[model samples]
Target: MQQCYGSIIRRQQHLIRCLSTKMQSFSMSGLEVDAVSVLRSLAPALDPNKHKGQAGKIAVLGGCREYTGAPYFTAISALKIGADLSHVICTKDAAPVIKSYSPELIVHPLLEESYNVRDEDKQSISTRVLAEVDKWLERFDCLVIGPGLGRDPFLLDCVSEIMKHARRSNVPMVIDGDGLFLVTNCLELVSGYPLAVLTPNINEYKRLVQKVLNCDVNDQDGPQQLLSLANSIGGVTILRKGHSDYISDGKEVKSVSIYGSPRRCGGQGDILSGSVAVFLAWARQLASKGEHNTNPAMLGCIAGSALMRKAASVAFEDKKRSTLTTDIIECLGRSLEDICPVH
Candidate 1:
């Protein structure tokens, strides 16, 4: 009985700390949002009666010969974040390797790179790829674009078509890594889609600013610039990842400056993309049911940024200098549980 009382005290203390963090974040930037509260509200309770794919079905449209880990990371992260189903659509060379990483993923080796396809076969192959993706596109609650996607012109062309189809079907997408690269060149792919979320790091954000704003990244006017960028792209939400993630959906700008690990490990962005996808799907469902009136994409980005930062902080507490991306990922469940307990 005493131990149980102690556990209750500890939990209460943790809750207080979480609230304090939110207050602190709010003070930092007037635009800072309460990420912990957002996370709790967006994360649905686990229901025993929920059927497969009811919670969420996430598909990652990335992976190529030179890159497989990114897609695997994104797909698995979706599963780890409580998505009912996770799929990876990658090149044949990447499919086997991504499959080797985890059996939890449904790997589809349908994408073809330039070297593997002849000039004469491009049109037919592109059509086939789109048709194959079309079969599974509507079923997914969200699609995470980019990750390990190589910047192969041929592969990107196929993915562009896939994006178009996904848009037609009204599927939300979290674009990151190489996916941002593709969108940077062709802004129209996700330009007006409010359901689309772009997670861009320093370099990716720079390119996007240059392309869309026709100028450089101004630190002094960061928030306004982000607002303009999102507005210029037709109000698609943009999550500018950095020390403090700045999110904008054109209407307003919100910042998530939650504490995170200092270790700059690779693949963390992939986790963010996957996390955002899952949360975006949940938020969208809630919106559809009239549970919340806020923009799902904005809520998704806020929750995802908070969760990823908290997870990284937890992993760093344990591993410190040795903390890797996988370590941060392993802490995701615990971090989320702390913020929004399953019970």
Candidate 2:
């Protein structure tokens, strides 16, 4: 009877251990990070002596005749999220429209589509485009690519060159929307660059797996797959956006699953990309100060995901079903204050 009782207790202990491991794995599978703490750590402290542009200088590299709203949302969001200077590099047709969206952004009309240039002018045009972007590239702390980028072959070709230049300068980049489409086809642009971050939505995540791993996405082993994809891409960080955002840097996987709204509205991704850029800049600064050895991309993704979810939740509370991207953008400052409290 004593032997049988001891056996039963041992089995129960084993069962409890298994349950605990499974629960941990499930939590790590989604947006599961110490997001509030990360946000507080990444946010720069207020200082009276800091100069202008000391906070961050961010660039948005997308805008076409058809899609101006995306770049505008991205650039403006960076400013709202505490970036000091925001710039937009876009085609001549897109420059004026994007400029009209706000006087705050430094809008550059540099990019040209194939339809507008003669075949003989292609070489010169490409050279000029590179020159224009090169003059401003090194000054930027981070660049957000592919917001409203259309699928024009000529335009994408120029953007390909721009990506190479950004990689050469070792400047950090956050790729999203059409940017993912471009990088998915040509993996070499960001392959092996630690500062590069790719933020992909559900469909974008599926396509990335098919392109890089040559297989379908496995939700059951999502974290492992995300780690593999980041590893396969030469250590570039990936933030797989979904019901919960999963982030990986080829080293470890983390998730940030707090404060979300069920609205599923469009343009939220743009807000996230913009917010990520600012936090990434801050994280890099903190890393430079030797505060922590954490991956800046990973920290940026966690904070950005958490902040966007918080703002969305706040917006939804007020407007409920009517909450739009603009409404959420309006809540970013308040949300950040709630979490980190500047004063």
Candidate 3:
């Protein structure tokens, strides 16, 4: 492991040098990482000999009767990025809708809302839900929390239990949307877990700052505040989504300022969460084999952010004002090809 990390550190230095020499003669905010290089290094080579589930198995833990598109967007995003399987665990009413969205996804209608369950059954239902999730827990490479996850009290409690189990099992998670809501209230859930990644947008970022740091979001020294935020949570990665997505794992801050679209679509963050899950999986797989030894969480954020931005740009050029989140997702393959083409 030491030798592997040594080689990776040297390679990272080389990439940084290249970023300075090859790119334009202008200074960029934060450390401008060579995101394309990182993506290429992490993405596995295609091999016909590899069987099913060798690539990745991703699960999205969100979706309710009121909202099903969020989970569908996330799960399909993983499949489009070359994951082997995509599973969505949602409420009973949400399962059929999410399944109807795509036959490719494995929909489990197992979660319960407050209106559907009695107080006497909350404990047993929560236990049963956790059990069902546990049966397939170790099989997944990553779990994306809070896509269409509503703010129901009982449902949130069950999801909290699921998060705890995932932590115990050492499964990585990308928390977004309402998952941030759950984590904001209970920081201990991801306080020291290195594998937990928080993808907080503008509003979510504000709430985290207030709750975790006891201060407001400081735009004047954005990277510094971001560093403090991540460190405050004990080094879990934070991918602060914005015009220039800034990533920090409590040590250093890296920014990917690639121009995306002006259209701020709703499901774009879902796409990013799914993308990060796959890239993080690939990075960790390599690390397990002593291939590369940096923080997979940060690499995953950088690569995922870069790819999503590129795809958004392409989609905007093609569709202009009509560019939606779905359009951006449709361009994921082409954007990746633009970065690192297959031979």
Better of 1 and 2 by lDDT: 1
* Model 1 lDDT on a 0 to 1 scale: 0.94
| TM-score of every model versus the real structure | 0.92, 0.92, 0.92
Per-prediction count of colliding residue pairs?
A: 0, 5, 0
Q: What are the lDDT scores of the predictions, listed in order? A: 0.94, 0.93, 0.92
lDDT of 3 by residue, 1-343 (tens): 9999999999999999988765543545337798989999988999999999999999999999899998988999899888999999999989988988889999999999999999998999999998999999989999999999999999999899899999999899999999999999999999999999999999999999999999898997898899999999999999999988999999989999876889897899999999999999998999999998899999999998988889999999999989999998899999888888888
lDDT of 1 at 23: 79
**Total clashes in model 2, counting residue pairs 3 or more apart in sequence or in different chains:** 5
TM-score of model number 1: 0.92
Worst 10 residues of 2 by lDDT: 24-33
RMSD of each: 10.0, 4.4, 10.5
State candidate 2's TM-score.
0.92
Write model 1 residue lDDT over 1-343, tens digit each, in one string: 9999999999999999999888765656698899999999999888888888899999999999999989988898899989999999999989999999998999999999999999999999999988999999999999999999999999999999999999999999999999999999999999999999999999999999999999999997799999999999999999999989999999999999887878998999999999999999999999999999999999999999999999999999999999988998899899989999988
